[model samples]
Target: MIHPRGIKSLFLLMLLFPGFASAQKDWQDFMKQFPDHLDISLLIQDETGEPLFQQHAGKRIPSASIIKIPILISLMEKVDEEHMHLDSLYTLQASDKVGGAGELQHLPEGSRITFRYLAEEMIRISDNTATNILIRTIEMDYIQHWLREYGYEDTQLNRIMMDFKAIEEGRQNYTSPQEINDILIKLWNGAWLNENSRAEIMHWLKGCADNSTIPSQLPAGTVVAHKTGTLDYVRGDAGIILGDKPLILSVFVEKFDSMEEAESAIGQIALKAFRDFGR
Candidate 1:
């Protein structure tokens, strides 16, 4: 049985994208497999940036490492403008260490690293230490201003990753599925950073080691350039799924009963979209 909210969502999607009515029905029906308690926000667009499906995509929630997307973009913009060089080095400090999904914290202090290395680790491993370093190097205030200037009012990187005190103070980073999809679409269309900058970012994203979300259940050899975000109660994956019909997909699952279940549901939803779009 479709949840009442799902029914309303289906109606709106059909009304918004009439050509996708049949596909929407199939996908929405599959959505019933997820329990009503889970908060799932999703946005799927074709290469042209047309929304094929969405649900609560504009509802902002804790972003986890997904906030890195904007940070990465901010850094790349500086590089494109010749304001920063990827080859430039920044030395690590004891204060820069944080406990989370990265190896940088294990490295000794005083280890000098390049901006390119920091950027790569930030995306490829969701490195909290690298992220904090880049956040400091790029200036958090500028990133906040850039987000507002671009009208991403719902997305903000207010605190460094894995900062427990900040979390206790409620200074968490937040973003919505729609916001992420919009960013990825621009990146896909060459509307954001220069070609080289975008390519470098994509290279890092494609190598991301976390395959437990969107890419978990995909057929082998699928080319997916994406980022995954995880916290105690939030799980998200946003990326460009390349194929005959290239797609931009962002799925964020929050407030779930089980981590395993949440990740499984995300993969199932993405796989369903892959099939729907491939046809």
Candidate 2:
């Protein structure tokens, strides 16, 4: 007679493999649903290192502000190293002020904000001013080393937060869907950050000020830890969709005719992913 533990193990394996198979098939079907003209790249992978869907997962794209992931990671590492404190104050300067999507810019110069508060603004509201301040305080080489150590060669922050010179030189910033997905997965697993740091990051991401992409199509109660990046006609969202089985996803669309069109396309893709594999 087979052992009781063996029987249980067999049953568990049977239950898990079917869901994996179904997720893969659903992703394949969804890829064929979209038109060929759209310049898009996407990746959906479950927590078990299984890819549910993939399309141009390796292609490089202008990350816009999505490059902030590295900046955020660098900050956390600093906290871990005892070089900084979450509650430590960072005084905003004129150089830190940059034009972008956020409320920090509206605040007058010399506004004092805690590092934790700045991190919240950076992720929650995609605040460029807060991002710049953090970047300025945290060394770029440190951020670059963090990315390389994490095996994210394709994700690079070539310039400080919203540096116009870099933007003008065609080196604004860049990352891949695969890279973003990897970052989100690491963050979700608390591997890239200490326990407290991971919790704080997720809390901020959950309240992301912009959710027009991934969260826009999911159910009301679906928990998504995500970040959205936008500039003119470009739009991108990357995050982990937490449900019964969490799936890491990154969808980037650029060169669209208009922001509205880009958002609609992203919504369609997200809806399909949710309906097909989010079960």
Candidate 3:
């Protein structure tokens, strides 16, 4: 049975589509194919912000690398506002390396990199080292204030990437499926960002190296600008799927014993959304 919290969103979907009942049944059955212990949160919207589907979308979860999307936005906002320049260079320090998805950690200390390079690598490779560099450069306080000012109260960057000490202290980055979808909506509509910044953001996202989640089961070469996140039992993917009927899909899965199972679910969900909504 679907969680009670999802009923409101399902009702909204039913109101928006004439054949939603049949689609709902299909999704219900599809969800049953996953292990019962697995938890999923999803939000699917059309390019115009119409809610196509939602399931526990408000449930905040460990964002893992998905937090980088907001960091990217925040950085771009600063760049556009003239508070920072993308061409500015930062030197890597021995203290900056973090043990996670990235090659920058292995680079020798004193390596200099541009803000643009760090931003791109942070998304393209899910580079934790690069992410930390950008986060430090942007300053945690300003990022937090920006999120709050922009109405992303539930989405937050509470700790830098790979910070075990902060995690032990009960601090971790987090975002909800709905919040992610909202962010993607802005990107889709070209809101806030200047032309060059928007182009650069989409370019980096389209180049995301990890296609093992939402893009795995998509049609070969389907254009999806997305981000994937992983942390122990938690897994997620959120981005724009450009095609006949463009879509913004954000999914988070947790409490699963197998990473492959969680990721496969993510892929299957995206594929189903593509086919179902494309019709």
Cα RMSD (Å) per model? 3.7, 6.5, 2.5
* lDDT (10s digit) by residue, model 3, range 148-265: 9888967899999988999999998999988888888897789889988999999999999999998999998799999999988799999998879889999999988889989999
As a TM-score, model 1 comes out at 0.92
Rank list by lDDT: 3, 1, 2
Return whichever of 1 and 3 wins on lDDT: 3
Best by lDDT: 3
* CA lDDT of each prediction against the hidden true structure: 0.86, 0.77, 0.88
Winner of 2 and 3 under TM-score: 3
Candidate 1 lDDT tens digits, 1-279: 222444476578778877669777777888887999998999887887667777887788888899998999999999998999999989899999988789999999999999999999998999999999999889999999989988897889999887889989989899888788888888888888888988998898899888898888888888889999998889899998876698899999887988898999899988888888844
Return the TM-score for candidate 3, rounded to 2 decimals. Answer: 0.94
Poorest stretch of ten by lDDT in candidate 1: 1-10
Q: After superposing candidate 2, which stretches have Cα over 4 Å from the reference? A: 1-29, 32-35
Decreasing TM-score order of the candidates? 3, 1, 2
